[model samples]
Target: MPGVKATALSAAILVSAARAEPLKVGGIDLDTPPSHCAPLRDAEVPKAATLGFVSGAMTASAVYWIHREQRRRRQPGKATHPREWAIWTRLDRKKKGYVTRKDLKSLCYRFESDEHAEHLAKQLDPWGMDHINFSSFINNFKVVQMMRQAGRLKLWHRCCGLGVAGNVAGHMAQAGEAGQESHSATKPAAIFSYYMPPHPYQVSDQQADKKRLQEFPVTYAVIDYPKLPGACKVQVEPELGLLVDIVYTKDRKRVDHLVPRRVAAFNDCSIRSLEGAEKLSMKKNWGFGSKGISLRSFPVDGFGPGTFVDFLALVSYMKRDGEVFQYSVKAPVRNYLLFHEPLLEWIVEQINGQKDTDKWEEIFPQLAASDFPTSSWIALGAGEYTDYGATHFLQPLDEVVVVVYDERVMPDGPGMAQVLEMFEDTPAPAGSVMLHQTFV
Candidate 1:
């Protein structure tokens, strides 16, 4: 009693008077609100937000480091884009994950063909793909490859089909290796033309006068390249860019190109528009293949100075002074792409190297010529030249090869050298050229 008496009794009396909530005895209430909510204060909310940001930044840093490492692996001095950076956020199921290769394959699988079914089939074989299955895998680039090689694809169009599926190799594969033969895959290519018919410069003078056709003169210039059979060779430069073909007759005496042929800059004549002369004079057109639609060049030579022939060495020439002309190779359909990258092997060798080869067997028996056909090339337009130029072809030119390389013909030293040499002529493999011919 003595211990509790003094201040305790006074405090108890005061506490009893103050013990109350915002209460109304009848209707009136008495209470004052705190400046902030007790449970969720404004200051506390901001502190929570700050914590969230810090956590998010840490997460983002981890993802960025991974991507940065990946980009570094691809090629030196390469950088990533904002969109690619978004891929990290996508791993969170609630967030957007950009499409991976599987997503693309699914898109390919689901896509019902409106126009590409048959074309895709004939073409699929060269790449060892199945028609519908390949359709799912083939993106814009495969489309371009199909068109360019249609001439060949037509022969075995129904045979190509690839069966690549998602494998764990993607994750387990580590980066870094020295002196590895590297390659890159390009897609949704444009169609390129390989063969253009000789121009009709052979028409008699009366025929020319009657039809009001201009003479497409043939000019001979010496160019050299590693592809030439001997030291160097003189060949007709096809100006698909100029919309003309330079054709050579069995008899070398007469050669002709498409109408847009170049003439020697004559004396006392302004070098302006002599029409035919100005047209044919240029060589090596550079910009023939930019995605799809692009500019035109004159003779594949004026494409870009010193690009292609530089790959070729200097060679001899015999000039045809009489006249110069062009031959047009306009054909059955719209300009399409011709692709020939299939022959290159795609090796993801950590483990799939062997497994992939085995899977090909299941997919290979059904394979046809279309599975392994040449589809496109770096066809140039006027002033277009082939560099790493990713040109497209409308229709691929057909080649009659004598012998296709069989496994027994392994690419060992000299064997491979011969094969590489064949790239120069790109001739029908031995015994393939038609023997029966009539000289025009």
Candidate 2:
């Protein structure tokens, strides 16, 4: 009788432990709101219709216009013009080109001259080298300025890479669904984030409210991937994990076929006639059409959900002049440093309004030597700026070419497999978005 009672007590303790969940907020379970509560995030997508008829109409129109334009491109017998040829080449360079990420890293390293290296160290050592994190970016602006003056440029550069990658990856994991879809559900599918031990950046809407309960710092591991010419990326509202979240949109938009407006303007109409109207759509005026659409992805949220990191929305835009419609199969990485006036000033002095092959190498010393992140987001070209209210980001990848990872070598494509392997390689007991992980 005594043994049996002891056994029963043990069993009860086990059951209680299993039932001990993190906590809930507003009647919503922080772990998985959809399951613990009445509705799943994905399950409520149809309710997106409430975004209103006008928003729906605009979305439908934009979607239809995009599709219609695609159909028109299928119409054959169209001769390729020089302008179209140029756009295709740029798109091809970004998609199939030989440039590897290592190439960019090397460029960042090499871009720095002796003077640049000196500047970096000075920035990292603020307060006469006594203070840390002070002017280290996490600290206030005064400290940051002190560090920069002290030569800790490389510190911010490194932090920029990590922060940019984190935000870009988070943005990619979310799917965009107008205003109706709550932030808890679909977000923009430009990037995804996870963490080994969970840090401050790994906050999700689900756990946001519960932070005060457990009071543990949420960690974030950001992952980014590029889209192949044949694929698009979509965001999914799964319980957890990476690839599974990108269930449908792995191939929504590629470098889309564009209308040859420039050719139409110059060849079909005289340049003089277009001077006035082109001024509106011109790259100089609107900062588009100088190139085609370039696809990219970005992680708006630095981490998934569990902390106080600012909300980051993955963004996409078009450059009709470039003739390339880019989709950041993951979203693009945008950072504060790129928006800094000095950065633009540096670029303008280099380009000098025209290509000067001779001076190209001379300006190398001035370019910011950033370790760089997976700048999956797309932009036609640089020299344009706007404040979308984002802080701590990455940019200057205007000419940073990209390429596709072979899909056949390993399923889910190379990028996905590599990212998954990164998780497994860490052999982390970290909770997965989807629990389908296997150890090889």
Candidate 3:
């Protein structure tokens, strides 16, 4: 009877905490519900006065429960909505704990027309990712619903860039021996053209116009096949892509904060032939579908050691003529020379301080003039390539697969045989992000 009474008391406390008006205990606002508790407000609250008997023990228990609930709601990686969790479970029929566009599209077709289903799937996956975990699913669902109601459910765009960390084993030497000899290993270069401005910048002279046009390549469409521009040889540059939130200064001249939200596999596919290329970005993007990013991504709790990031590793392969070849040396993301908070700090410095040099273009002005996008996608750096990867250039119909997998699941990394088997299908490993792109 006492346990039943305690359960009832707990239920009443939860209801009181969901009330609109503040429930104060020693000036603490217990009724101020957490953001995730919006649905809780609709529940009926039993009057505490009706209980007829109030004990000191019960009052203390109520206060403790409210405080604990508040703390639990604020923790990272927690699902925000009950409805979204239910929807995710239904869509993830394979019990993979995540849903993909294919899953959503298949389910949507049951009720919506083919075209409508496709549009709904695309809108729900604004990032064009391969899989949507519960947290991302909830966020995407809310955004798409709001945009649909507003009649603006098109593609959501953000300004982003890549970091050229030259210290990843033999990556610097593989890029070019000259860069290895001259470039500082500690400082990474920033190539800020992952998503260019929608509109071109107006300039006075022809030279200035040309400079602005150089930064206008739309290169973030990684889910599609890449077109080989002209007869130039193209190769895939496998790297880790960080989806970060950018906070700009009030004046909008500088970046104040760069918080990384998720990490995924990315292919900063590049042109091997640099003829007439004055800057690095010139070889980076050749128009739409020139770069690649995995449809799958893992939430980043923190960048430090012993965090979620430490468990991940990067490896890549090339599928050619029905044969698979190892492309990149299997490397842990933590093996980078600069990572964690130091890596973020370096990126912030580069965004604000990088200038127009013969090798690199000015970045801050492009971002500033583009209204300072709130979010960015950054490819950290390419890993060292194997001899086959270093010598081979992507031919027509060659498919590149870049994977970021949890080492905790597969200690030795993903087997190439298994990778080839899953080449045309969804990645089999949980917590793995794969970027599969074919050259046309």
Give all candidates' CA lDDT scores. 0.23, 0.24, 0.66
The residue-by-residue lDDT of candidate 3 on 173-266, one tens digit each, is 6866235553446545454554555433454565344343334332221222334345265778888888888998887778897887999888
Candidate 2: segments with Cα more than 4 A from true spot: 1-110, 127-135, 138-403, 406-412, 415-440
**Rank by lDDT, descending?**
3, 2, 1
Model 1 whole-model lDDT (C-alpha atoms): 0.23
What TM-score fits each model?
0.17, 0.18, 0.61
Q: Kindly give the number of clashing pairs for every candidate.
A: 97, 89, 2
The local distance difference test score of model 3 is: 0.66
Q: Model 1, range 102-174, lDDT digits (tens) per residue?
A: 3333323323222454454444344533322212323333463333334222421221111111111110011
Superposition TM-score, candidate 3 onto the true structure = 0.61
Q: Please give the RMSD to the true structure for each candidate, in Å.
A: 27.4, 29.7, 24.0
* Poorest stretch of ten by lDDT in candidate 2: 261-270
